[model samples]
Structure formats: C-alpha cells, structure tokens
Target: MNPAQSTQPTQSTQEKQYFDLHTTGIGYLNRIREVSPKKGNPFLACNIAALSGAADDVVYTRFDCRVSGKEAEALVRQYEDAVKQDQKVLISFKIGDLWADTFTYTKGDKTGQTGVSLKARLLFISWIKVNGQLVYKAEKAERPQLEQDPSGQASQGGQDDQAEATSSEDSPAPAAEASSSPKEAPRQSAQIALPETVQLSKDAPDFQERKAALKQQGYRFDGQAKVWRLPTDAAKSAIEAQHQANAQDWARSAQATA
Candidate 1:
C-alpha cells in the first residue's frame, strides 16, 4: 500500500523455472560410464531417450544425467538390469540440474541427428511390466529395487535380482555420460528434466508493490497462506523482472541513506 512503491524501474534477469520437475516416458539406458569426480563415491552416468509417440512414430528427446542418493542409486541398478532383461518400464524423474544441450550423430558426412537433452538427478523406475505381466511396481515412496530378481519363463525369479543388479560394485555412478573421444560428431553438454517452479515469493522487499503488479498480471493472493498463487508460468518472466527492479531500488535507497 505504500505510494512510493507503486512505480518501479525495469529489470532483466533470467531464472529458469524447471528445477523440481516430474515427467513420465519410456527410458533408454543407452550408455553407462564409470567416473570418479572426487574419488571413492564413483558414479555411473546414463544417457536416455524419452519417447512421446507410438513406437512407429516416436519422438526422441535425449537426456544425460547422474544419480547418487541411496534410493536413487538402487533404482538405477534395477533400471540397468531391466534393460538387459528387456522389460517394458515407465520412469519418473526428479530433476536437479537442466539446460539446453545438443546431440549430433554424423553418419559419413550427410546423415546428421540432433535432439534436446533431458538430464535428471533422481530417477525412479516406478513401474515395470515384463511379458505383459506387472512383475514390479515401486511403492509411491519406494525406490525401484527387488528383494530378489524376477524368474524367467521357466524358473521362479526372486534377491538374486538385487545380487545381479549389484553392478555398482563393479561400476559406481553420479552422471553426465561417459563417451570415449570420438572424432565423429559428439554430444553437447547433457540436460536434466525437472519440474517447473512457481515464481511467486513472499519475501520480496517491495511486497505490496509486487502484490499489486501481480494482480495486474493475474496472480492471486491467498490471505490465509499469505502467498501469491499463480495458475501457470505464462507471465512469470515479467513478474520476475519486476522483482529484480524492486530489489535493486531497495539496495539503492539503503546506500543513499548510509
């Protein structure tokens, strides 16, 4: 409600909203690499492709990412085993870092392949269907690991699955991918897939002015929670710009008085 806070200067800042993200798609465990970034806690990097359409006309969006948390590490092991066993699965990703990346495949001068990278930090192989039977389903809060491996068509499968999946002993993990230096067209930095974050914040210095600007931009405020709520990210850039300007003005005022 402060009059001086009504008008503010323009600002330019770009903060991505895709931090905590969730996406569902078929995953590709194309390549796995062994890396020791700081040593001891070595990690396996994975390259994946998320398909959106039917197999005949599927679109491939690539992502190169790493996983390290206890639950995450276990789930990845199951993922690799599933790949070798040729199981049909769906994945849920909790993205930590993400950015634009390019993958170019050059097949002798003329054939070029390019795609978008969707990297992730924590990936949960939530559902698995083998031979049309739901053999594995990770609980909502559970990581994808079996107490025992599933049986083949003939024998009963049971912990042997975990034992077989213990590739981490032979190969630990983190991520980004592992590729030998190829003279051919190489992949760019990989990107992770994350959920989009909401822009509304309650801690801005010019809270009242921001509230007014958000009202103009169609963001609604809930008195109970004392937070501005937005239906979508359609006008987020503009609102963030205003937030930056307000912060700058406050900084300048503090300096002038000092």
Candidate 2:
C-alpha cells in the first residue's frame, strides 16, 4: 500500500463535498433565482406657477451623505458644498395660502364701518426633505381670488343676538337672570382660550449644534465633512512654531556637517 497516496485526498473529493453542500443549502437556491431589480435613489421635484404667467422648471436632486452609506450619498453631495462653507442654501420649497381679512365694526355712534383688517401675507419655509428626496423649488405663487365673497357668520348673527349678548354682558346678572333681575353683577365669563405653545427640535439638533459650538470656540467649519478647522490666527501660530522647530534642527544638522 502506498501510504502517501492513501493519505492524500483526491482533488475531485473536495470539490464533490462543496458541490453537495451548495446544492443542499437554501441560500444557494436563492442565489440561483432571478436577480432583483436595483431600486434607484429617491429624489424630489417641485412644480411652481409663475405669478406673471411665465414658464417653469422641475428641480431634481439626490442626497449622498456620510451619516449613512449609499443611502445618504446623493443628499450629502447635494448639500455638501454649502455645509462645508457654513453657508445658508436653499433646502426646500413650500406652497400655501395668503389670507386677507376685512373688518366690520361700529365706532362711537357711527352706524357701520368697514375696512381692511389684515394685509395678505406669504410664508416661505426651507427644511430637509422628509421623504425620498429633498429639494427647494421656487415659482410664483398665485394669490387666491374670492369667487364668492366670504360671509361673516358672526357679523350676520343679527342685532337681536348681539343686543341680547351685550345687555347680558353689561348687566350685573346671569344671562338667564338678567332678563328677570335689573341689578346684579354680570356673571363672570368662564374663560378665554389661548393657543398652545409649540416647541421645535433645534435646527439639525445634531449637525447644526456641532458646527455652532465649534464656531463659538473660534473655529471655522470647512471641508465636505464640515470639519472644525482652526481660525487664521491659530493656524498662523502653529505654522510659525513648526517652522522655528525645523530651523533649529536644520542649524544643528548644518553645524554637524561643518
């Protein structure tokens, strides 16, 4: 018996073991299945109408960033330049209503008075895109026209209700008892309701804070990563110190050579 030949496993033997295991595994079967289509990165587009009635365009963008791989790549690339320089850049576009208010009231003995109470206003917001893509697109926003004049429900409630409410308000008696009693302290109003306060998470509570804190310490944020860089003064000092050290070493080297 040739001991060497007996001990050495044939090359075909190892390959067969691998082939058997591969065919039996579930993962191997999955690999044989059709390859899934690659889902492309998400993006946002804005449609704005020109107020003067001009042509418009669509904004396309993908985010590429460092926080997350492949996913943030497009987004980070989109805003990377601005973030590096600590500059403000367009983030997103918003469309909404501009409201106008007209007031009707009586002054002194004047029977009726009407005038513009509030001028119409427009609000623009810029922020991170919540969904797949983040983009800022601006186009003229048309102000809504009053097709049918808005009716003032409170104003049209009639003088009867107003007189009754006013009399009850001024009289020193409960609304129910006011009609019955001529003299009594007007029942106090239950209470007036006020809007609740809204609290917002700090601007990029994470990223923005890092940049702001560095700036407070006299460091400038720069580079695509928005690294905290030393200011000009500190940079100059560091350079000078390095140069001095180098000069001293050079002097010693030159003396030794001499």
Candidate 3:
C-alpha cells in the first residue's frame, strides 16, 4: 500500500434520499371505482371534496386519489354502496406524493379547455363518518417495547443507559430546561399537563371562525377524538382565550335581556 494513500480516509457511498409531502384532512368521499389500467395492476380510486375555510363560507378542493394502502382501500370499498346511494360519506384521510396533472377536457361545459387535477395516493383512513354517524375508526397501533433478556433485565442496560445520557447531553436543551427557574417550573409543569388535542362544542359562539383560523395555522382536526390538535402551547392558549371570550359574551347578552 502507498504510505499517503493508506493514511487517507475512505470515501463513503451515497445513500438514496426521499422527499415526501403528505396532506391530512376531512373530506366527503365521491366517485368510488376500481381503475383497471392497461399497464400495471388494477387499483382503487376516488375523488375527495376536502372541506376548508369558514363553515358559513366553506370551500372544497377536489383530490383525485388512488387508494394505496390495503386497509384504506378496504375501508373505501365498504362505503361504495353508501356513496352510490347518494348518502354523505365523510372521512378523515391522509394522502401522500401529491402532484398536479393537466389534461384537456374531452366532454363538458369546458370542452377543449385545459384543466388541472390534484392527484395523490390515499395512504391512510383515519376515521369514517357516514351520514354524521361514526362507522369506522383506524385503531392506533401500539409501539413495540424494547425486548429484554431471559433475566427480565434490559439487554446491555449499563451501556445503553450511558449511551442515552451522552446522547441527551449532546442534543439541544429541552424547552423546560432552557427556561428553567424556580418560579417557572410550576408553570412549565402545568403547561405540560395540557392535552395534545382539544375539542370545542358545536354550539360555541363563532366555532366555525375559530376552526378555520386554527386550520390555517397548521392545527389539524382529529376526527377520531373530535378535537383540534396542535403541538404548540401557543395554540392551546388561543383556544382557551376563545372559550373565555365566548363565555363573557354569553353572560353579557343574558344580563341585557333581563
């Protein structure tokens, strides 16, 4: 071996990287059918009228989705009869690998006009509500715990603990730790006690407006829990303030009527 060449570091092989874009929301299921393409396998496809904006002035964005996951496909197929019957089938869905496909209209009011269709693969069916009734909900898969040895003790316990401690030290400080103070600890703990998601009553004043605003700010509605969820404390504060304001307004209105 050449002296200088042997001392040099070996070049590492490049690994493949993937960029994924996923959209999750509630929508009305429509146009359910099995598409048998000339090439490749037959697949289930459907159109989703995704709901957005304020309830009073709601907006719908149509997505031409291919059912990708086996469970999602099964769930969608089960609702085909209901959809065909013209009954409303609402679902909380997750779509991935979205793209816009442009095509010329063959027949319609806009014949010979070019149109863009939003296309994506329906990867998950979070929950299904048919005609305002909860019918199907995807079960949350429990995470597998680390297995232990025959002795009921964690394998390589000491070494793993030391490694975890070292990793934590190298990582950026957590929010609680970064803002640590004698007076702030209790406040931090109280904040931590708040749930990851919150549900508001349909009868709440300006509920539609609040929902639209929160959705725009990246808060997702959890269909299963019937709640709006965001990981940030700021969102929780906003929701609390909205509730308080609603209460005060209701009280003032009652007094005036008396």
RMSD of every candidate to native, in Å, equals 20.8, 33.5, 20.6
Worst 10 residues of 1 by lDDT: 167-176
Q: Tens-digit lDDT track for model 1 on 1-258?
A: 887674554454445554343443444444555556532356767666544444333344566667645665666675676655544333433444343332343664223433333445545554444333445655544543323326533221223233224212212111222222222212222222222322445553333533454564445666777655555563444444434443554465456556
lDDT for residue 129 in candidate 3, whole number 0-100: 71
The candidate, 1 or 2, that scores higher on lDDT is: 1
What TM-score should be assigned to candidate 3? 0.51
For model 3, residues 123-203, the per-residue Cα lDDT tens digits are 887667766677876554511123465888753333323432332111211122223333221111111122356455577
TM-score each candidate. 0.38, 0.15, 0.51
Candidate lDDT values, in order:
0.44, 0.28, 0.59
Question: Residue 140 CA error for candidate 2 (Å)?
Answer: 55
Order of the predicted models by lDDT, top scorer first: 3, 1, 2
Winner by lDDT: 3
Quote the positional error of residue 111 for candidate 1 in Å.
12
Winner on TM-score between 1 and 2 is 1
TM-score sort, best first: 3, 1, 2
Off by over 4 Å in 2: 1-226
- Deviation from native of the Cα of residue 190 in model 2, angstroms: 80
